[model samples]
Target: MNFDYTLAFAKELDQADPLASLRKDFLFPKQNGEQFIYLCGNSLGLQPKAAREVLEQQMANWENLAVEGWFEGEDPWMFYHKELKSLMAPIVGASPLEVCPMNTLTVNLHLLMVSFYKPQPGRFKIIMEAGAFPSDQYAIESQVRFHGYDPKEAIIEVSPRAGEYTLHTEDIIAQIAEHGAEIALVLFGGVNYFTGQWFDMEAITKAGHAAGALVGFDLAHAAGNVPLKLHDWDIDFACWCSYKYQNAGPGGISGIFVHEKHFTDTSLNRFAGWWGYQEAQRFKMEKGFVPEAGADGWQVSCTQVMPMALYHASLKIFEKAGFMETLRIKSETLTAYLIFAVNQVNKELGFEQFKVITPTEAADRGAQVSIIAKDKGKEIFQQLVAHQVLGDWREPNVIRLSPVPLYNSFEDVFKTAELMLKISKEILI
Candidate 1:
């Protein structure tokens, strides 16, 4: 579909957008008395207006009930995460029994690894993306070390072809086929954080399984940004943080998915805690760990009610907006418009110096458009921020702008591009 990004066209698009009113539900950050065109949802999402009330209610419960709040509050702290299962399940395409809200991303990754990363005598290797997020790299490295394996020998780090910014799907499948028998686990980010490329989860899972390895995903960037089918894809496990695209505030609760096939696998070992013990026997002060029946079995500690409240607030908005499908439609169009405008600017500048590192195909990417300005990249980024076009800067040279469909508009994309063109001519040139 051809998009004419004129101001009138933008206005007309907004006028017809069914999700336009959802923007008013968020609190946009302002600078110089004007709202910034927020394109940073890939880093941190704008806070929902409902989050204030949700957080306040938790504060009120704490003030009135104190320690008793665990069982006595309106939304009991003891079972706080339970309230989020239904809301989060659909977002990730999993059954409620397969999903659980819990610890931070890396922490949950480690916990899931404990159960999923059982390496046999000769076949104990882990496969992952080479430029994975630092936290994930550290976690995987530490897990290999903790298991008395040399990471250099036991971990396979897949990289893009020389001089490429993204990994090709064919390369990934070929790699799996070549080393499938020796691999124990295949762990990768569902959508790479830096490149904003969405991997083929189902395809990856199938390849891993065909090679006799368990598969998992670190969905920190993918969750709420791209549509997922964890259960249907037959993925073994997955984990994600809520602070980014989920808009659940900083360091909010993370989530996990454990396939039903592993639900009753007693041989699948885990680092158990009291919370993971069977609820009926939990209060009995049991001597042995009797795990919960499904994904909830992975819980190691009690839920943090405050952060759970914040997550609830955001999930409510997701539920109201019809979740992934609706947001995805807006996200694809908005990102396409931003890409179009940026390319136009580069053409007008008479130099194809700006390169979009993120994949052009909508199915291969999410909302983020990662651009590398060949020269004066940082200067261009600073100019964009100064012009109230908020984006994030990665090391060396990438400028990542994410047009979150829930809060960002087509006009915001237009104005952001207009500002970029102005900045490039005046300062970057």
Candidate 2:
């Protein structure tokens, strides 16, 4: 309850943290012999120290066993991804059989669409947010076009009311209700990347189901950033990339979840590959595709062991830190402190020089805070970077600062605010 911005207080909180020891697991970035205040985890997470060892093990297997690494090695390359399901399932609130790690985010999205988006006459539309990531927009548009439907007609995008930066839950629900009957699929980001607004997946899924549509989510920013209940929410399917909050390095392998009820739906269509073939009979080189029941049936190729190993190293840290509960507590306080500090700085500057675009309520948002500098957005952002306060710039004016609970400290948030104050003064003059 007590939010103090003192160095002694921050050190005390760090000492009391159960997950404090987990910080050592990562290789923090340094600048000019000093550690950089990394508030850019939303873009790319810091490297895990254990990641090197894990990847090295795979390198040794590839060296010593050669092609035999697929079957003869200690951890067979063919089944490397199977080891990750148990660790990832709980993170997304899914059954172990309902989840699998394979392919990339956009690739998996297209793959899932093949199975879930069955466009029937008169009811063949896809509903999504208007300001979705460009990749998602492209995927949805391409999918609609591939099905011989005009994207302009088949894609119904929901946008915020005038002069608003974030979408409201009520507005989203109303939009779904208005078009649900004609929509074949309801796909949306679990959290809007730019606004940092966490959508109500359960409510949206329920609305879609009530209107005879399938629901899916792209959880690139939400997967490890917040607690999810995908299975309990009865979400039909979902996909996510692990490079961001999952800390699995750049271009890491992605994951997907399919409800158990859909596992035996023989009518569901998919673009099958050998990897999805039944594991028991796969070696026999069967004539037809007999998919391994559940989400594993979606795998299109053999696992990429190096990225999988990196993911394993990070998942191990999540496991040791008690996953979401421990991290969520710290995330709430850290983000609140950052917002509070930023506001304090703005008041001292004699005018509203900066604004947080993220939701004010912690329950409605995640760890990242997107800020817009009123006068010199880009100039102020560059100054902050020059001061060694690392955040990311998005388009014309926004700067995203993510205070990750796993490694980012209260002091980092304080220092970033101080740097912003100094930068603003220089820019205004």
Model 2, 77-187: lDDT tens per residue? 887787899889888998889999998999999999999999999999999998999999999999999999999999999898899898887888888899877899999
Please give the lDDT score for candidate 2. 0.89
lDDT of 1 at 220: 95
- What lDDT is reached at residue 168 by model 2? 84
Go through the candidates in order and give each one's C-alpha lDDT. Answer: 0.91, 0.89
Residue range with the least summed lDDT across 10 consecutive positions in model 2? 1-10
Candidate 1: tens digits of C-alpha lDDT, residues 1-429: 687757787778788888999999999899999888899999889899999999998999999999999899678888878879989999999998899999888999999999999998889999999899999999999999999999999999889999999999889989999999999999999999898999998999999999999999999999999988899999999999999999999998999999999998889989998888897778898698899878989999888788889999999999999999999999898888888988988887899767999999999999899999888889989988887888999989899999998988888888887788788899756
Per TM-score, the best of the predicted structures is 1
On lDDT, the candidate that comes out on top is 1
Per-residue error at 293 for model 1, in Å?
1.7
Give the TM-score of each candidate: 0.98, 0.98
